[model samples]
Target: MKAFITLVFITVTLATYAQTKYSNEFMNIGVDAAALGMSNAVTASTKDVNAGYWNPAGLVNLEDRQLALMHSSYFANIANYDYAAFAMPLDDRSAFGISLIRFAVDDILDTTQLIDDQGNVNYDRISLFSTADYGLTFSYARKLPVQGLNYGVNAKVIRRIIGDFANSWGFGFDAAIQFKTDNNWEFGVMARDITTTFNSWSYDEEAFERVQNAVEGQNQELPETTEITIPKLQLGVAKTYTFHYDYTLRAELDLNMRFAQNNDIISTSFASINPALGFEFGYIDMIYLRGGVGNFQNELQIDNSESLSFQPSFGLGFKYNGIHVDYAFTDIGDQSVALYSNVFSLKLDFSIFR
Candidate 1:
């Protein structure tokens, strides 16, 4: 079994050189600290609101109504990402949830080449604008007729805006299945953007043309209306062990692949495959520690050297009286600490108090 797992990891790591490009890449950026700390390998794990985004089927594992909110500074503090979710069990066999994700960059300087009567340059007239992306998700999950199996789906609405000059609207759906065994093993499969999410873009032609003309040999303009997203599949497996019924440990692995056409220099759709590994230690169900590694890929170094990817993450969590707080830190490549990101999340369980 260990050999098989090792082989799979090696295969995924080798394929990491290829990266997928899709609309709303921010959607793939993890929102929950616990999940992010674990390198986003939570498809088969449960008991948290993050499941609404990772694998809806895991919602069935939630034991109480929950409200969760998270925030993170991304990419050298140039942007901010925020997420909020609410989940409640509809009955003994079903659950319902909703979540919102937003990524935004503020105070961007929108500059245009300016010429006075004498063709002089003016740098003081630069205007500021912002770009934002949003996703709203509605989810439902239920226990299947067969024991230990669950299924769920997420319906999503997406929006993107660039300083009032361009904007887009999109819609997509995601589905997942999870199964658990009596021996503390769990498996999950999630099909993200199952129907090929689409985004219709509208741009101010006049403004767009001005920007296009300013750049030399720039002819690739966004379409006025079209689909912008592609489908992806993620599979996960996990196992849990208990020590004297007080201390518990869980290990998980996940594989993610995109099935859409990639037109980049590396045209193989298989190049987008990625693998992740994670571990969690829990104490009395009140405190937790997590570590993970993922986002493996290839990039060009400052000297045009081949550089491999390395992303490590760790997190700490505490729960008290129905409230949970989590903190996580993740390194962004080989850059200094300034390139790293911090994630913080808070969760409240109403049922826990009841």
Candidate 2:
């Protein structure tokens, strides 16, 4: 019930502000520094610890001990996120993994207006686009007896902070089932951000008081309420096929059930399935190249042609003894070239034991 409410409010807020401001939505874009470089999709067969982010079920592929850390730098010098995960095999059929992800939007300078009813500009103040979010995940995976197939699930708690204000955290869960076919064909299904959250957007008495006084004079009480909603309910099904020559083919279909419209964070989702496809290849285990095209219907020459901007991405990766590094480039489809320029990331993985 709480999850349902959060999504409702987040959606309402987005719909209201969609015409004016751009907000972050599906691409809450994680800090998988490496996977960002390769258009992701490496999780189904990933043997490294970073698998915890892509598909917790992939942890079942970890042979022994591993630890990984990743960081991503986004556009506008805004929020930067870091992710760390540890994984180990519990037995031949099961593995346990723990992951921590932290997000901190860089301090921002915002303008606040102070004016009289007579259209008099009294004064203005500077504020910040502030937010601090963190998520903790506990994941477990078990390999099914048949043909290297595995099933995994992760439960997580997400918390947020903004300008001395924190809202009640929302809970989320991820579940995926993976299957491997002969040669190197694989398939996966995942549900992400199942626990959509909406934050308490109550104005701070200390901070909002300034705006109140600016508009309402001294002791007049204002009668208005503000609330924001977060979108919820997403389901994705993906498939992968690998060649002995080290070439990989990947594709996924993601469906975001938007019960309400959130123009603020445009994606052309409109309660339907969005298609994404990519391929990757490596030469003798040294260098890798990957690329993909994705997005819902939108107005963009490079992608969709109506609602939200489209996304086309590509990535590169390198591997060495017990360590691997990767990177990716993405187009957010924003009209402003600078804002839509690109999204980049880096990932690092190390083996703790043989």
* CA-RMSD of model 2: 7.8
Residues 1-354 of candidate 2 have per-residue lDDT tens digits of 332332333333323432422222423454454455444444455545766666777788877777777665556656576777788889988999988887777563333333345766543533455656677788888888888688888877666554442233545667776777775566665555544433323435554444334322333332222223343443444565566866655554444345444433343445444444556666667677777655544443555444554456777777776566666666444333435324433334445234
For candidate 1, lDDT tens digit of each residue in 138-204? 9999999998999999999999887756777999999999999899899999999988888877777
| Model 2 CA deviation exceeding 4 Å by range | 1-27, 42-47, 109-129, 195-204, 214-270, 300-309, 331-354
| Shift of residue 232 alpha carbon in model 2, Å | 6.4
Kindly give the stretch of ten consecutive residues in candidate 1 with the minimal lDDT sum: 9-18
